[model samples]
Structure formats: structure tokens, C-alpha cells
Target: MAPEPVRETDPTIGRLVTDASRDISSLVRKEIELAKSELKVSAKAGGLGIGLFAAAGFIAVLAIIMLSVAIAYFIHWAGLGLHWSFLIVFGFYLLVAGLLVFLGVRSVKKVKAPEKAIEQGRQIPQALKGKS
Candidate 1:
């Protein structure tokens, strides 16, 4: 296969090509900025997710410890032929679990997206045009 010859007939064609090149370069820069902004957002989201999961795991372990205490109490009370005392311990466990779940939900609700970077990304093109 032979390579095609390059041709430039009019001055307008040259100007147009230059303008097109500038536009493409501007667009690429804008896209890079957008990607960076999005990556920052994703990183923040991922970090929050990891933190929340860690908290949930900690809460789960605490809940297990509470349940163990309840079991021990149940065994002690049942040994004295009192079954109702076990119910009290079980209820305490339920209350603690419910409170933890409520707190977790509130924490999740407080999480907000990092919007400033995204807004800056949006404004870059306009800033570039003003510079030109």
C-alpha cells in the first residue's frame, strides 16, 4: 500500500485546521480535568465505604459479645430454675442491635458527595475560552 499525499489548497483550510487542532487540545484538557475530578470523587466514596464497613464490623463484634453475656446470664438464671431472666437479657441485646443500626443509618445519611471539584471541572472550558 502507498501513503496518500498531503494537500493544502486554501489559506482558509490551514486556518481551519489550526482552529480544529486548538479545539481538540482544549477538549482533551477538559476531559483530563473531568477524569481527575471523578477519580477524586470515587476515592472519597471508596474511603467512606471502607470506613462504614469497618464500623459495621466493629458493631457486629460488639453485638456478639453482648449476646455472649446474655447467654451466660441465661445459663446462670436457668440453673436457678428462673427462665424469665433470660428474656430480659435477650431484650437488651435486641435494643443494642437496634440502636447500632439506627446510628449506622444516620452516618450513611450524613455522607455527601464532594461537589466543588466537579464544579471546577465544569468551569474549566469557560475559563479556557476567556483566556483565548
Candidate 2:
């Protein structure tokens, strides 16, 4: 039986394969880093959202207390005692409530989803290819 000759890839092809593999490995690493960065941004945004809710709740409670005191004062000024003072206090509370609602809505609307890090990471390869 005749011995079969081993076929080898050209050096250029071999180098291309090596380079492609390295490029892919680097791309994978960059994707992982991008995901990590995105996740961190998302976590921070979530934390901010929670904090905003907490602040809104606190402010609501404080507003209620303040409105109560204001009503008492209005009643004393009216010379009608606490009974008639409630109307003025209630109006004040309505204004505060409206303002708070506006602010809360604004804050919620301002919250943005984290930008995709992987998308940005992919651009690097595209840019490199373009430059070539």
C-alpha cells in the first residue's frame, strides 16, 4: 500500500485562523465587560428609583402633619376654633399633594434604562474592520 501524503494548510491560512481566533476571544471578553458595566448601571438606577419612592413617602407624611398644623392656625385666625379651620388646611394639603404628584411623575419619567454595553462593544470590531 502506498503511503498517503499529509495535506497542510498554507502558512497564510494558518495565520489567518490564529488571528481570527484571537479576535473572537477578545470580542467575547469585551462583551462580558460590557454586560458587567450595563448591569452596574441598571443596579444603580434601580437603587435611585427606590430612593425616590422612599423620599416621596416621607414627604407625604410630613405634608400631612404640616397641613394639620396650618389648619389649626387658620381656625385660630378665623376666631371659629379648629372646626372651621379644616377647610383652609384641606386646601393647602391639596396644593401640596398636586405638587408632590407632579414631582414624583417627573422623577419616574426621568429614569432611563441602561444603555446596552454589548452594542457599544460590538462597534469596536466594526470600526476596526472599517479601518482596514
Candidate 3:
């Protein structure tokens, strides 16, 4: 007796399921790879942006120093002694810096720990053990 030939057009249920799972897995992997690549580009751009911002901030600081010098020179032109004019500008900057440090310390002292999240974290092991 001759055996029947397998038809390619009609796939078995098991074969279909296997094909579907393989296709889904491939799709998921491709999506993950795409996301990783996109994230890499985004991270590179973000790093570049941060560097540019830092450069800008440094430039701004230089500009501020120049302005401070200009102000001191203006004060000297207005008949104050050059040394005293520079000294006054230096004193003003020192006072402003001290105030900022004081305020920063006060703000930092107000920071509290995350109490609720900590309590929930403590409950995680008990929950896993099936205890309330």
C-alpha cells in the first residue's frame, strides 16, 4: 500500500502553534534590540547635551567674573580707591556664597526618609511566605 503524501497547504495544529510561538519570540527579540539601539542613541545625545550645558555654565561663570571686575573698575572710576573697590566686590560675593550655604544646609536638614516605601519593602518577604 502507498502512503499518503503530506499536504504543505494544511499545517497541523501543533506545527501552527510552534510557528506562532517562534514568530512571537522573534518579534519580541527584534523589539528589544530596537529599543536598546534607540536608548543608546538617546543616551549619547543626552550626554552630549549635558556636556554642552556644562560648557555653557562655565562660560557664564567666566562672564560673571568679568562683570564683577568691570563693576569694581567702575567703582574705582567713581573716585573710590581701586583696592577698596575690589575688596568690596570680594566681600559681597563672600556674603552671598555664605548665605547660599546656610540655606542649602537648612533645606538638606528638612529631607526625610521614605517611610511608607520602606514599610512596604519590609512586608515583601512576609508576602512571599504567604503571611499577612
**Superposing all C-alpha atoms, what RMSD in Å does each candidate have to the true structure?**
14.9, 15.5, 6.1
Q: Put the candidates in lDDT order, highest first.
A: 3, 2, 1
For model 2, the superposed segments whose C-alpha errors exceed 4 Å read 1-15, 83-132
Model 3 gets an lDDT of 0.99
Q: List model 1 lDDT by residue over 2-91, tens digit each.
A: 986666664587799999999999999999999999999999999999999999999999998787777767677667434556666678
Q: Pull out the clashing pairs in model 1.
A: none
Each model's lDDT comes to 0.85, 0.86, 0.99
Better of 1 and 3 by TM-score: 3
Off by over 4 Å in 1: 1-11, 80-132
lDDT of 3 by residue, 1-132 (tens): 998898988899999999999999999999999999999999999999999999999999999999999999999999999999999999999999999999999999999999999999999999999999
User: Global CA lDDT of candidate 2, please?
Assistant: 0.86
Question: What is the TM-score (0 to 1) of candidate 1?
Answer: 0.50
Q: Against the true structure, what is each candidate's TM-score?
A: 0.50, 0.45, 0.71
Q: Pick the candidate with the highest TM-score.
A: 3
Model 3: weakest 10-residue lDDT segment is 3-12
